[model samples]
Target: MMLYLAQTTGEPTGGLAGWAIDVIDALGGLGIALLTVLDSVLFGALPIDVLLPLIGYTASQGAINIGVAIVCAAAGVVVGSLVQYTLGARLGRDRARALLVKLPGIKPESVDRAEAWFARHSTKAVLFGRMLPVVRPLISIPAGVERMALPKFVVLTAIGSLIWNGMLLGSGYLLGENWHQVVDIMGYVPYALLGALAVGVPLFLRRRNRRRKNAATAIVETNTSG
Candidate 1:
């Protein structure tokens, strides 16, 4: 669900976002952190990106401190992401894939691509993948499945979360009353990502199949020679 802030009052006065604002006001930075945790662990559980900028807008109005907001949000994201990673680790690949593929918007193919991406990129996928929208949460699954070092996973997740949070918060602070403009721009991202996936997934599958066939052929030839 999306939260809209009232431009005149600089407060989220209605809807889910407004409810979150009420909580943030009552609990301070910790509230923001908790919400961010929800954002990461549960798909579509909260509109955290939108909420972050609104928090930034609040900071700009002197209602909250920007630095504190950034720290709390980033910390929350890391913690939430860890939960997802642990799920993957504990579930292992086959079980994890079976469960994940059943989630409302999660596609079986997306899981396949995430695993493949991690196979190719290893550590860098954990580091950089945290910044991408579709990949951010999903990437953690692959990391956990591959048994990435806990220390390394935390460090990379923290770094990426900080960068992602800082950018949104900074943009909200700068935009001030006009922060919703960012929301407008973000709305189109899903469509763009869909187009990319539609094209990319097929190509990825073809390459993967070709590689497997080649490996199989090599094995057959080696056995014949023996």
Candidate 2:
């Protein structure tokens, strides 16, 4: 995907860091925005950190304007979100069930669970689900398959997508050339969170064991004295 973005922006697909900068140089403001939106909606992907740095570089080079870049990026986000929403509405659930049957380890029960979740939460699921990586795209599928009311789906999707995209893109604009670093940091976030949990679990167990030992000692002392 990064390579494709580089190619679209007229950069040689060599190193991502250099290619991102080069692409911004080649594409200018409108080009960057168009590429950002196209990647997000159609492909359901975005190289947010890389693109922002490119935008910053373009701003530095005087090849593109920042305000224009922001507008274009936001527009692209909206366009991409709409495409995904439409796809979800169109594909619905029957097709998903058919596809699920072909996949290994995917069961009908899981599909039912998904449908039930959507039925129960509906709006919250659609909105919050957009922020989750794997869940975001999958949420759309059930929404479509169930024939969720078109207006409601659109409203929820738009709101969730806007918030998600705005935060990322806005960060890009604010961080400027260093924006890619934010992406790098984000990439490690999941691993860091997992590591914290791993360390915390053992510590919690040790503390619980010490408490149990102390309680047992206290009870023994009381009974012996009695």
Best of the candidates, lDDT: 1
The per-model lDDT (C-alpha) reads: 0.80, 0.59
In model 1, the runs with Cα more than 4 Å from the true position are 1-15, 184-226
lDDT of 1 by residue, 122-169 (tens): 876777666567677688888898889999999998897788788788
Instruction: Tell me the spans in candidate 2 whose CA falls farther than 4 Å from its real position.
Output: 1-33, 40-71, 97-120, 185-226
Estimate the Cα RMSD of every predicted model relative to the unseen true structure: 7.6, 10.7
TM-score of each: 0.75, 0.52
* Tens digits of lDDT, candidate 2, 123-204: 7677765555444535656777667777887678667766655555555556655555656654564465446656875898
